[model samples]
Target: MTNTPSNAAREESLDLASIPPLESIPPQLGSPGGSLPAPTVDAGWNTRTKALEVLAILALAYTLFFARAVLLPFTLAVVLALLFRPVVRYLRKRWRVPEYAGAAGALVGTIAMLIVALSLLALPAEDFVRGLPEKLDAASVKLNQEKLFKSFVSMQKKLNGAGDLGVSTETPAPPRREGEDDEEPEGDDPDYAALGAAGPGAAAEVRQAGGVEVEEEDEPATMVVEERPPSLLNRVFSSAPEALGGFALAFVFLYFLLAEGDAILNNTIALLPTMAEKREAVGLTRAAEKGVSRYLMLVSAINAALGVCIGIAMWLVGLPNPVLWGVMAGMLNFIPYVGAFIGAGVVFLVAYLEPDFGLLDAAMAPLCYMCINLLEGNFLTPAVLGKSISLNPLMVLLSLAFWGWIWGPTGAVLAVPLLSMTKIVCDDVESLRPLALLLGPRIEKDDSASDSPDAESEKPAATAAPAVAPAA
Candidate 1:
C-alpha cells in the first residue's frame, strides 16, 4: 500500500507536468477558454464584394438597354425560329426536303400569307384614308349640332377666358391715318392701281361717268390649299427599306437557327459540366419551346376567329371599313389585355364617327367587341391552353408593363410568350421553383382541411378504434 501511494504520487507529478498550467496551455478554437478568432471579420471585403455584384447587375442591364438595336432582331429571330421550327421539321421529315430549303420554304410561305392579307386590305385602307377628311367634317358638324356638345364647348371657352391660360380674346384697334380722325374711309375705297390696271376700259368708263364706278362683280376668293403632314402609316412605309433590311437579317438568323437547331442545341448541352445538368438544360429548353409555341398557335387561332366575328358583325351593322377593323383587331390582339381594350376603342371611335349611324347603332360595334373578347377570355382560352400556360393575372400585367417599358409595342406583344417561357425554365430549375410558383395562378385546395391537426387526430382515432363484436 505504501509503494502504491508512492507510485501514484510520482504519476500525478508526471500528469501535472504534461498538462501544463492553464495559462501556458494553448487555447483551442470553439473551446470554453477561446473564441474562433472573432470570425476574421473582413467587413470591408464583404461590402466591396456586394458592391461589385450590384455594379455588375447594373452594367448588364445598361448593356441590354443600349445594345437593344442589335439584340431586338436576334431575339425576334429566336422567337420566330422556335415558332416555325415544327413546320420546318415536318417538311424535312415528310418530304425529305433539305433543312435549309425547308426552313426557307416555311418562312417564305409565312411572309407570302402576310403580304397577301395586306394586299387584300390595301384598297380598303386607301379608301379609308381618302374618306377620312369627309368623315371628320361630318363628325365635327354633327357634334356642333348636338346641344350637349355645344354646351360643353361654351363652358370650355368660358373657362379658358376666365383662366390665365395665355388665350387672348380682345382685338387690337385698327390703325388710324396720320393727321386724321379714326373714322371709316368714305364710300367704297377706290380699287388699287394694280387691280384697276387689269380692266383699264372699265376704269376709264367709270372716270368718264363722273367718278361713279360701275361696280365690277366681286372676284371669287382663291382657295388656299394647306398641305397636311403624312400619316403614321405613310411614315412607316417610307422607312420600309430599313425595316425590310432588319427583317431580312432576322429571317436569315431564323433560317440558320432552324437548319442547325440540333447541332446548336447539342453544342449548348455539351457546354454543361455534367450529363445531369445537360439533360436538365435540354429538358428546360424543350419545355419552353413547346409551351411558347403551343400558346402562340392557340392564341393566333383564337384571334383569327375573333377577327372574323368582328368583321361579320361590323358588316351587319353597316360600319365602314369592316375589314380594316378586323385586321386591326387580329393584329392588336397579340398584345393581351391592353391590346383588346385598344382594339375595342378603335371600333367604337369608328362606329361613332360614321355619318349615317345613330348613337345606338354606334354602340353596337363596341358591344360586339366586348362579347367576343368575353367569350374568348372566359371560355376559349381556358379550354385550349388549360393550366399549362396559366399565369397569375398580376404577374402577367407586371410582365407586360416591364417588357413594354423596355421594348415598346413589340415587347408588349411578346410579353406573354416570354413570361411563359421564363416560367417553364424556372419550374425546371430546382433553385428557381419558388419563382415558378409565384408566377402561377393561385389554386384553392379541397384537401386543405384534411391536412390540419384536427384531421390528423381524427384519422388516428378512427383507424385505431376496434370494431365491436356483432350480436350472435
Candidate 2:
C-alpha cells in the first residue's frame, strides 16, 4: 500500500500526542523528554539554615559558660548520683533499706573519709609549705654551683656587656674648657679616657693608684623585691564558704536524684508516643547509667591503687611526706594525659628541693611516678574499660580541652565520664550511630559477614551484570 502525505501527517500527530505532558513528567527527567535536570533550590541544606544552626551552637556555649555557677554543682550532683545509684539499689534489694537511707549513709561515709584523710595530711602539707622558701633557696644555690649554670650565667653577662658597649655611664668632663689643658695631671694619671674607650668589661687601672674606689661593673646592684601572690592555702581559706555552699547544694541534689531516679526514668520513658521509642529511650538510659557508674567506680579503685603504690615507692625511696604525695597523685590522676605529667613534675621539684637528695635520688621519684603512670594508662585502664566504654584518643583529648575551657580543673576531671555518656547516647540512636563509630575506638572489619547466608544471597544481585540491548 502506497502511503499518502495526509496519512503520514496524521501518524506523526498521533505519535506526538502519545508523549506525556511536561507537568506530568518527573523533575529528574527535565522537560518531558530525557535531558539534564535544571538546577533547583537545594532541599538538603541552605545558607540560612546552616547559619541558624551555628548561631544556636554558639548560644548554647555562651549559656553554659555563664550558667556554670549553678550548673557545675548540679552536674557534680548528677555524676555522684550515677556513681552511687547501683549501691542504693543493691542496699534496697538485699537489706530492705530505703534508697534515701542508703544514699545518706554513702554520702556521710565519703565525707568522713575525706575529712580523716585531710586531717592526717594537713600537718605534713603545712610543714612542706612553710619550708618551701628555704628549700627552694638551697636548691637554687646547688643549681648555681653547677658548671652548666655558670656557663649560662657567663653567656648572659657577656650579652649584657655587649649591649652596654658605646653607652657611657659617667658624667662628661664639663664640656672641656676652651683654653684648659687636655691632658690630666701626671700625679693623678687619670685613665677615664682609657676606661671609656676600652670596650666592654674594662675596669679603671688608675683607681688603685689614686685610692679612688671604682664600683665593679661585673657586680650589678640587684634590689630583690619579692612579690608573692596569695598562696594556695589562703585561696582555699577564702573560698571555703562558697565551696561549702556548693557542696551542700550538690549533696541535696544528689540525695533527691538517688531517691527518685527510677521514678523519673519511668515517667520519662512512659511519655514516649510509641513502643519502639520508649524501648530505645529506656535502653539508652540504662546503657548510659551502667557505663558511667562502672567507669567511675573502676577508676576510683584504680586511682586508689596508684596512690598506694606511689606512697610505698616514696617511702622506700626515703622521700618525706609520702602520704601527701600519694594523696596528690590520686587526685591528679583523675585528669587524663596532662594530670600524670603535672604530678610527676611536682614530685621531681619536691624531691630535688630536699637537702638529703642527690641528683639520682631526685630523679628516682618522678621516674617512678611516670613509670607507674605509663603502666596504668597503657595497660590497666584499657583492660578494665574494654571496647564498650573506650573512646577514640583524639575525641578524649577534644572533650578534655572543651570541658577544661568551660569549667577549669573540675571540668577536666569530669571530661571522660561526660564523653563516655555522649558516646553511649550516640551509639544507641540509629541516626547517630555513624557519629558514635567515629568517636569510638577503631574496629577491624568482619570478613565472616561476607560468607553468611544473607550476604551470599545479596552477592548475586550486587555483582550481577546488566542486560545488553541487541544492536538495532
Each model's Cα RMSD:
10.9, 11.7
**Highest lDDT model number:** 2
Across residues 1-472, which tens digit of lDDT does each residue of candidate 2 receive? 4679889999999999998866444665555666754557788678889999999999988987888888888999998898999999999999999977888888888889989988999999999989999998999988888687799999999999888858668987767658757554333345444455553224335444674466867967789999999988899899889778877888888988998899988998899899998987888888878877888899999999889988888888788999999989898898888888999999888998998886777999999999989998889887876556668879888988999999878889888878877777776678988888888842323645776789999888766634332332
lDDT of 1 by residue, 1-472 (tens): 6799999999999998997445333355346955434345676998899999999988976776677667666888888887888788788889999888888788889889989998999999898888888988998888788787889999999988898778679998998668865443333445335335546666666657776546799999999999999988898889788668777787778889988998999998899999888888888887777867776788889889888888888888888878888888887877778888898888877887888876677888888887888888899888877666568889989988977877667778778878877787776678987898899942324445677778888987776565432332
Candidate 2 clashing pairs, residues 3+ apart or interchain: none
Clashing residue pairs in candidate 1 are none
* Collision count of model 2: 0
Best by TM-score: 2
